[model samples]
Target chain A: MQSIGKRAAMLGVFSGGAILLGYVESLIPVLFFVPGMKLGLANLAVVLALYYFGPGDAAVIQLVRISVVGFLFGNLFSIAFSLAGGFFSLAVMCLAKRYGRFTVYGVSTAGGVSHNIAQICVAAVLVENVKIVYYLPVLLLSGLATGLLIGLAGDETMRRLGAPPKFYDAVSNQ
Target chain B: MKHRERRLNRWDMALVILVLAAALAGFLLELTWTGQGASLQITVDGEVFGTYQLDKDQTIDIGGGNRCRIEDGAAWMEWADCPDQLCVRHTHISRANETVVCLPNRVTLTVLGGEDGEVDTIVS
Candidate 1:
């Protein structure tokens, strides 16, 4: 298992992985949901943050990634959507971290679910009609599934490294 | 580490199934909710020409030069003195805020959907 510092470095690595995932997902062409939405693998960094560094760091990392990705490959409209999803998911994960044990998987799951809901809400607000709310039930469904998988991945990653909260020490400034 | 966790709780399974169902429902709603607030407003040479109601049939006189029957919310030039007969080829505008411009006769068709008129403009 990589130390937290290396894991932090992995943030950049995961981001590269995520960028590749994003482009690949887009290329598949056929969409299960609205044409605009995607799996957002870049969130792996956010998942890593909550588990290794703490929720605050996780939130900051997510914000930075969202901003950079928006500027690099997105338009103004997409940026707004990213803000809602990324911020909401991070906040949810942060809160979950307080109540739940330091399980990286669970935190990541919470973040994933919250991210999709916020994005859907933003879309509804932008269209100036709640009629778009019909998309909510589906969004929730997708969120739940994706969240679980993301959370599980984080949890397994930690377990395999034979590390717990102590793993975070690698990146701990103290 | 990401490739390993294949086991998921029952809740996880339910969540995925539920979301897939909801997505299908939303797609169906989109298919049916094609209602719009306005239709084709065609103009020619600064003259008050005609209007078209979508999903229905009608006709318009384009400044006495072209006469077209309005079929399916579009004005096709049934008869035109203009060359190329492009005005007659105008397709119906089902989407909101879309315009089919006919430059040869200086006629334009614009489709306005939803309550754009009542709602204040925010941003494009």
Candidate 2:
């Protein structure tokens, strides 16, 4: 396991990276022309943490990033939808990674699809309108596309970053 | 390290295929399903304010300062106090279970009276 200081430093870097990418993502206009839809560039940081630091650290990164980013850049409703999406996506990715069946890309794609599905579900509940579910098809397609892109980026990043010194490889290997 | 060494594999391809299949399924479902609402159900701030028949053309002054016109078998936002004119710009909707929502005003006009609408009404 890494020292406490090293862990904190890494977490800080990941959080910063997530926020920066989120900003970059917000700048890009989606092809679908829908609010709250993007490349999900922030998840790149989450993917990196999940692969490099293990799910526990990855989970922490997810929460901190959402809260900080949502508080700074988004509103309460956006935060709620993002939290719902992020939680489910993280859970699926962690499970897939731990199972060791799918590669990084597969795990990331699962995260992406689950993220959109969960977000739409929350939207439906909030609006009290099931017609919101009509947006699912578009969300699913975009999620797949973005997930694949993020996964590929994460794979290369993980390969390049390698493992940290004193890394808890055994724990993350799960 | 072992997991890291394992890059894209057959399993990864399988997962991609599965995701694509799911996406295709959703797309097809959306394309094929048609809204069959018989009436327009207006909701303001999540409350059922009124329901209007699609067959009848009428103008409505929805509570909370929103106005909509139903004409030619369709309903559309004629006026709204909301900042964004998204609801006003939305095309007339006549299909069952279709909706034109004004997020800022918390007004939703949903098509009611189809099979799905009946089920939704019961559930809501």
Candidate 3:
């Protein structure tokens, strides 16, 4: 078993990496025509944490990343939106991973789609107009594409880093 | 061992197909719901500013360094000084309920149709 200090260090590293990735994502030019679409690069850290350290650690990293990024680069509304999306996405991804029937790609894709759906729901409430739902189709497609890309990256990174934790093996074998 | 674990399985393909089908269905549903609107309604900070006939070609300066244009029965954000310019980049909207929103400027332009009364009932 890892020592307490070692586990804490791992958490800190994941959180820090997630925050850095969030900042990098903000630097990319907005994908015009789709107001909220993004590559979601920061999710890589969360995905890694989920697979290696489990859902609890992944949730911690996600929350830290969203709060820090929102405060630094966005307003209250953006923060609320991020919190909603982050929580919903993390929940769905956790469930998908726990089911053991899906690979990383499937889990991440589900996360991406849930994130967008949560944000759109928030937008509808704030704007007091359901017409915003019209953006759903395009947002869904973008989510699928970006999620697949993140999943591919996450899988390759884990492979190169060496054998996954024993838990991952057990999950996969099941 | 890891390579086999990373490979896409049938479940993954099924999930992707399901999401794609959902998107396509949503697109078709939206197409059926939208129709040519009669007027353009402008709102700022949650207050209704004014309504202009879509048939009338005109430019509306929404102050706060944002402008909207209506022509050929369609309305669009003509210009915006907001740093992101997301609203300005949006495509022209001619169908009922379509909108161009400038979050930074707190301005929204929505297309309204004579038949919108029915849509509002459904939404509410």
Candidate 4:
């Protein structure tokens, strides 16, 4: 088994990568007909964490990234929306990864769809209008496109990184 | 050892197709469903503040410094104090369940007709 110090170092690196991706996403000027739409670039980091670490560790990285990014680029309402989207998306992605017949692409697409749906729910409640759901169709299209992009990036990155030597060594030793 | 190629599989392609189909269906439904001879429903924060006939050409003060105008069987946002002015810029809506939303002002205007006059029912 790896030492605790080594795990902590890895988590730190993951969080740093997540935060940097979040910053880069914020810098991209993505204009959408619907308000509060985004490409969700930070999710690439979450996918990496899921592969390298685990779901729980990935959740931690996601939460930290949302909190930090929301504080820097948004307000309380925006933070609430992000938290709703992030948590729901993470849950769906984790479930798909664990119990469903889904690869990384399927999991990421589920995450993207759930994220948009959750954000729309928050917006509907906040604005007190069910009519806001009309925006769902466009949001779904955007989610699928962005999810596919993120999933491709994640798969390529993991293929390049390969399975670490430590994992095989630990399994053989056990 | 065999290397697994990093690419989208049939399963992923199927899921993408499914989502795209759903989105397309929704768009088509929204586009084709018309609310001809419907009434204009003005809602602020989800509450129906007022309803006006689409045939009635008049301007309504929608509170919060916003105004809506109905003319020529269509309704549009005439003026809005919101920063983005998106609602004001929106095209005239004359279809069932069509809506123009002002996020900044927390106001939504929709065209309701026949069985589609359920904004209150839906909200409640």
Candidate 5:
């Protein structure tokens, strides 16, 4: 129980760090290469959480980040989009981790792609026009590209973060 | 455990190459998708003012109000009646991240993925 408590505390810290990174990234002025397009810096934290922790923990972290950050930034209207993106990305990665014939990086890529697609779906719903769905192909392609980019980065980050001491012992015992 | 990478089969390679080719084609053809230089017809309101075309002398203004111009296959809102004038100040949009918004008019224009044949508009 003592060890478990310590581990939970560690996860809490990690979650806080990830959210801070997300918030900082959000503060930067958006640079759009095309109309209504933006580089997704904050999603890096989402990738990190997915990589280091189980998807459930990642989902919790994302929910916290969205709520806290959105509140601080007065982005209440964006909450639905964030929730839609977070749920889809986390769900996809969780399933992939359990059964897909892929590595963490591939799962991370899929998560990134799913996150963007889900957000766009929410946008289309809010806008109430199918024409808004026309953004699909381009968004998907960009998500694919960004997914690969973030996946590669997440892979490197996970490798560098090293194994938690307790986690290592538990896995070896299993 | 070390992360695994799936080996790309020939099929995967072929598909990747095909998608890359399509993206290239879309980027080149994007000039034709919207605006005055565009060969495709784009109607404003009830009338077909003009299609996307880049020819400075040949371009037709849409809605008989604001002007959206096309140059070398890219589109931009060059002028508008909106006070903020953010749309007019915006750089010509060719990439997916660009957009033009007329707050007063509630008109939002964006160039979709003619560059990659996929459209990614607003992300969460």
Candidate 6:
């Protein structure tokens, strides 16, 4: 088993990386003139955490990234949307990883779609109008595109980093 | 430590195709579901501002910062002083329940009372 200190340090590093990626993502312009459309580059860190550290650690990194980045760059409404989307995306990704015989691309794509749906749902509830769903088709396509890119990037990074230590798997298995 | 090759499998291909199909389905469904709207309703900060007939070709200044235009039975955000201007870039709305929203200005224009023949009974 890895020492507690070592695990904590790794978690901290991953959290910091996630936050930085979130901030970088915020800097990208809205693509295709679609409101709330994003590249979701921050999810790269979350995917890495999920694969290497398990869902529990992945959830920690995701929440930390959302809260810190949301407060830094967005308003209350934006934060609410981000939180809803992030949680839903992470949950779907975790489930896909656990049950489905899916690779990184499948898991990330599922995460992306769920994230967009969750955000739109929140928008509909807040605006008191269901018509906002008109954005779904475009949002879904964007999610799929970005998710595939992130998945490819994540997979490459994992390959280069090689496998985690045996004890790392032990921690994730728990 | 060496890991197995990380190439995508059939499941990944299936998931991608599934999402693409879902998107296409949603696009088609929306196209068929929306009917031509008779009027457009304006809401500012969750409160009703006014409702205007879509047949009336006119420009309305909303909250002194945004402008909406109704022409040829379609309504769209013609102008907005907001920084983002997302609403202004939104496509025209002629279908019932279609909307153009300006988040920065807290304004929303929703189409109502369409050819589907449901009268909007909600007052104010």
Q: For residues A62-145, what per-residue lDDT tens digits would candidate 6 score against the true structure? A: 888888887888766677778899999999999999999998889998998889888878777676666778888989999999
Q: Compose the digit string of candidate 1's lDDT tens values, residues A140-168.
A: 65676677677766666777754646755
Chain B only, TM-score of each candidate? 0.50, 0.70, 0.78, 0.77, 0.43, 0.77
- Candidate 1, residue B30: lDDT: 53
Output the lDDT of residue A58, model 6. 90
DockQ of all predictions against the true structure, Cα-based? 0.10, 0.35, 0.49, 0.41, 0.10, 0.54
Q: What's the CA error at residue A21 for candidate 6, in Å?
A: 1.9
The digit string of per-residue lDDT tens for model 3 on A1-174 reads 256676777789889999999999999978657666788999989988998888998998998898999889887767877899888999999999998598999999999998999887877666555667778898899889988999999888887765467645554444
Q: How well does model 3 score by local distance difference test?
A: 0.83
Each prediction's whole-model lDDT (CA) = 0.59, 0.77, 0.83, 0.79, 0.56, 0.83
| TM-score, cand. 5 | 0.61
lDDT of 2 by residue, B23-109 (tens): 789767755676555788887767787878777788889874789898888899999986546678776888765677776566788
lDDT for model 1, please.
0.59
Reference contact recovery of candidate 4: 0.47
Better lDDT candidate (2, 5): 2
Residue-level lDDT for A47 in candidate 5: 65
Residues B1-124 of candidate 6 have per-residue lDDT tens digits of: 8886748899999999999999999989977877778899888877778888888788888879999998999999999997667788888888877888777667888898566464453433
* C-alpha lDDT of residue A13 in model 4: 79
Native A-B interface contacts kept, per candidate:
0.11, 0.42, 0.51, 0.47, 0.00, 0.62
Candidate 2 DockQ score? 0.35
Looking at model 2, residue B13 earns an lDDT score of 79
Q: List candidate 6 segments past 4 Å from native.
A: A164-174, B1-6, B35-37, B44-48, B61-67, B71-73, B78-85, B95-97, B103-106, B112-114, B118-124
Better of 2 and 4 by lDDT: 4
Sort every candidate by lDDT, greatest first: 6, 3, 4, 2, 1, 5
Per-residue CA lDDT of model 5 for A45-105, tens digit only, reads 7766665556676777778877877677645556655777878877987886677655655
